[model samples]
Target: MSSTTQKCADMLCHRNGVLKCSRCKGADPETFYCSPECQKSDWRWHKKFCGKQAYVFDVELLGSSNPKITRKVAVPSWYTFKQFHFVLQYIFGPWQNCHLHTFSFLKELGNQRIRSDFSIRKEILLELCHEGDVEYVSQNWFDEREVKLSDVYEEDGRLRSKIMVNGNFAPLLYEYDFGDGWEHKITFVKSELARAARPLVKEAVGCGPVEDSGGIQGWNKVKEAFAATQPTTEQLERRQWAREVSGLEERYNPLAEPDVIVMNYEGRWENHEEGYREDERRRTAF
Candidate 1:
């Protein structure tokens, strides 16, 4: 038989028809889930990208028993719900139209945002104006001469790049430092990002910025998944309080003096104090 559908859908991967899957046959399907456990574990996010297209085993569809495998399997970058949500909307939306140029990876190119956890906060981001030296960026070249016209090196402020695209963080050239673990880079890009690579970017269009309505249901599912990641402060504190109350119940003593009991309860809510300044261990940072 000819060999066409015997490989996984991921072109970079070479799974030798070993990664058994129940939902789909042949190579990796649209979701590329290796097993049912994986599909269910990440169903919220996976359903979004998998779309509704049925996966036809490469060799089977081609009427071949085994084809020369030449697929490139790609690993996803974002891992958490928060990251998945942001990528689907921001990075994937407009940037989806542009070619994804991943610069960092232990192995593999054309991949970035590993496990997909990324976000942009306006609370700390410094904003810039339009009419700046943005024309140079559109030319697909980092021209120092053109950059001099704008005060891009002030260090105290940010450049006005993607501020127009991202409504909240607007203007891309702004930078941020998440922590010691992250690489601080500029965000947003108004003018042309890759002039020479325009064709590649065009081909990459419609890959990200998933509207709430789109996705084979993967988009909305991811939104729900992102929201489900963390328990609210009230929820956690309430649970903690319940355990504390149970412990106190076990330590109950009917012989304790009323005054002592009253004093203990009086100082219990010191957690909500906002205008007090004394003591090394009784302070809450938030």
Candidate 2:
């Protein structure tokens, strides 16, 4: 009944809670979820920091021809997965909203993958494994929107008694711009029991490729084109367009200073900003 749990965790959603974060209730009785649908939808990023003091995650951009792109971030436990996605997008730049993405959990034993559906209106599809074989278990998957990091993470051996104290759990996969096959591997580095006002970038390495520059192969091509001496007219034009799309004007040299981290997270909540701007525009129009 705390003020924090009085409403759903989703800012866009205003549902009063009948459902709460079961894992968080043991410590903080807040963090209630409106419904299973909301939990499933928000699971990816929320699971990183929910009900904990703080969480450190190591993120690496996958499928890039170059393997140097990576980032380390510290986030407040209460942030939703949707919020986390924006953080990744800012560091990697595409900066613009122009891609489809999904968060997936994969296991190596039998190559099983549990993915969260963007639309959580339907029943969740769970994967059951036995002796390296996998099968789909109906009605067993918890909606991602309703789940939080506290739900999946266990520090005191309460959730998984058999899990060793030092064992590392499965990593999460964040696949952005599916067409470009941009994948990121997220590993839980550590967690603390203190609260954070907001997420922060702890470290950053290597600059990501231009937005929608194909996949690994294409990224390599763009790099080569930029590095070419006496480049062709076509390559020059391509670079110009890339600079605009990437928002990197004179600082577009990847080889010179590629390890910088850009923090522009406010852009993610632009829809909220647009409304106010539009309202002011209407008032000024007359």
Candidate 3:
């Protein structure tokens, strides 16, 4: 019999469970189901976890001209690389997903220190092979949808801790928009108990760069134009371009604080508060 102190894992059912999931029997904070029917209904969400643990990560955007932009988030190990991509899109710039992306893993070879010259590396591409895409038959390349966070960070998210060198964990690199080269370093923080089905924002800092604002250099120019008291013709044109690309009616403020609440929600920023409230209600209901 399952624990009587806890309710069913199903969001819609709070009744005490009589049966536990065999697959996740030994998982910490194990899942329970009142019946096979309830378990079947919740399979869509539960399959992601199976029995894997959750992990917290510190994702920092690198090469940004602005102050260091970072986000601390909690995500389930079962989340696919594609799902993780969406999480990054939401937190960074609340970015519009208009470009290609890829996640790269760097491994240490001998005493090389895992710098850029490593002979061994793996890349997870946005697509394995599309109709018009060139074929990459090597094992090094994988489809984002086919890989999960757990597959990379094995041993229940302790892979980083084992590889820690000089008190620093090796970071997983993610690149978005090949042209602009929006690179981020994803470092493992710690393991966490499963709490929410959706990714949660633990912390956020600095606003993300506006889309189509070039790279760091271009973004700096946009900032300069907005900050100028007496604008030059080039500055005025740059400001207009920033506003037009970002769909902002007013001048773009690079230093504006990021809204964590809005970032956590999926839809438009206007309905973020309502979405947050609804999520809270559901969380507390059980």
Q: What is the lDDT of residue 77 in candidate 3?
A: 76
Task: State each model's C-alpha RMSD to the native.
Answer: 24.7, 13.6, 9.8
Q: What is the per-residue lDDT of model 1 for residues 30-128, given as tens digits with 9 covering 90 to 100? A: 334344454466545434333222111110001111121111111122122122222222222221211111111111111232213332221222222
Across 1-286, the per-residue lDDT of candidate 3 in tens digits comes to: 5578777778799798767777766354547788899989988978766765677999987766567789999887788776787677766764676666666554422222122333433322122211222223335456666777776566655233433456554557776776776777788888776545667787888878888778777777887888899999999988787777776647556668777887666345325434434543664486
TM-score of 1: 0.17
Ordered by lDDT, highest first, the candidates read 3, 2, 1
Candidate 2 lands at a TM-score of 0.58
lDDT of 2 by residue, 28-122 (tens): 34355678888777666466555557678898876544547788877655555545665566556443434545554443212222233323312
Note the Cα lDDT for every prediction shown.
0.25, 0.56, 0.66
Superposition-based RMSD of candidate 2 using all C-alpha atoms, in angstroms: 13.6
TM-score of each: 0.17, 0.58, 0.64
CA deviation > 4 Å runs, candidate 2: 1-52, 65-67, 109-144, 156-167, 193-195, 256-286
Best by lDDT: 3
Query: What's the distance in Å from true for residue 53, model 1?
Result: 16
